[model samples]
Target: MVSSDESLPQRLPPIDRALDRYPYCIVWTPIPVLTWIFPFIGHMGICMSNGVIRDFAGPYLVTEDNMAFGRPTRYLRLNPKNVDGGSSAWDEGVSKASVLYGTRMHNIFCDNCHSHVATALCNMHYENRTSWNMIILCFWMFVCGKYVNVCGFVKSWLPFLIFISIVVLMAVYF
Candidate 1:
């Protein structure tokens, strides 16, 4: 028997990298030196129903379609059906969180990009949970996120791999 829930995936819009549109996705990008050392760490953002990205860029700043680090190298697409109001609720959650973060100060350890994304998910009560945080989000993205493409895979891990190799070589020599 076919279920209505089973047809959700067919209704999602295709991702368009050229246009920088990723509907219902949590996007990620490397943070230069930081991400080069720890590949799991990076900037993150949430997207609207139309796929426009929204991120807490800095203190009192929330950017649209302008990720703080760069274009997203990876993304974790989410199911809107999990939201109470579906697409509209998802958009509202992202918008609410972006606005809230716009008035706050950026903190690397506490309140930052990841927090912004989490707030959105919490607002939408995603997966029936409001406990989203940096650790959970980071872990999920690292485990489940998909590379935008081949270039994305390289961009995300190449620097870390090179850094590790150089360190190993230095240790051997010294």
Candidate 2:
């Protein structure tokens, strides 16, 4: 006879433990063409326990693939507090949201991969739902270097910088 603790896997990191207990995981990987110009423009997905990733691949297609945008560079835990408790309730919620978005049309600026992940997390009632917005903003700051010292500067000027860069790049190449 073995103790309950002995039966469970040992020495896992907090995030790893969370992944094992949670129904879904958020993952990030670089978008091929976009990463060439802006390394920060990456794709986000909700990875189920079976290693199937649900992501917005393109318009009218929410895909479940092993390698959505190559291998994932990062895995973000959905809810850290729920790591020990282990709830299955959110699983159906996330799955329903995924199917809903999967059938809808995709939009680059508005309804893209990050939005898909965000919506899933939101359905799960995850607290830190602003992560998607932060990811985009941080990447824009990284690429444009709009605000080196001030957060306010980035908040104020990053949009204009992004707009200018897009217009300039479009004019030059297309």
> Candidate 1 on 1-174: residue-level lDDT in tens?
889887656488788988889999999999999999988999999999899999999999999999988899999999898888889899999999999999999999999999999999999999888999989999899999999999999999999999999999999999
Global lDDT of model 2? 0.56
- Candidate 2 lDDT over 1-174, as tens digits, reads 999986876432233322322125565555655654555566666666444567778876777764366555555544434433234534554577688886888787888777776666555555534344435533543444322124423433455567679989999999
Of candidate 1, the 10-residue stretch with the lowest lDDT total is 4-13
Give Cα-based local distance difference scores for all models: 0.94, 0.56
Give one clash count per candidate, in the order shown.
0, 0
Screening candidate 1 with a backbone cut-off below 3 angstroms (N, C-alpha, C), the clashing residue pairs are none
Assess candidate 2 and give its TM-score to the true structure.
Answer: 0.56
Q: Give the poorly placed runs of model 1, Cα more than 4 Å off.
A: 1-10
Off by over 4 Å in 2: 1-23, 80-86, 128-174
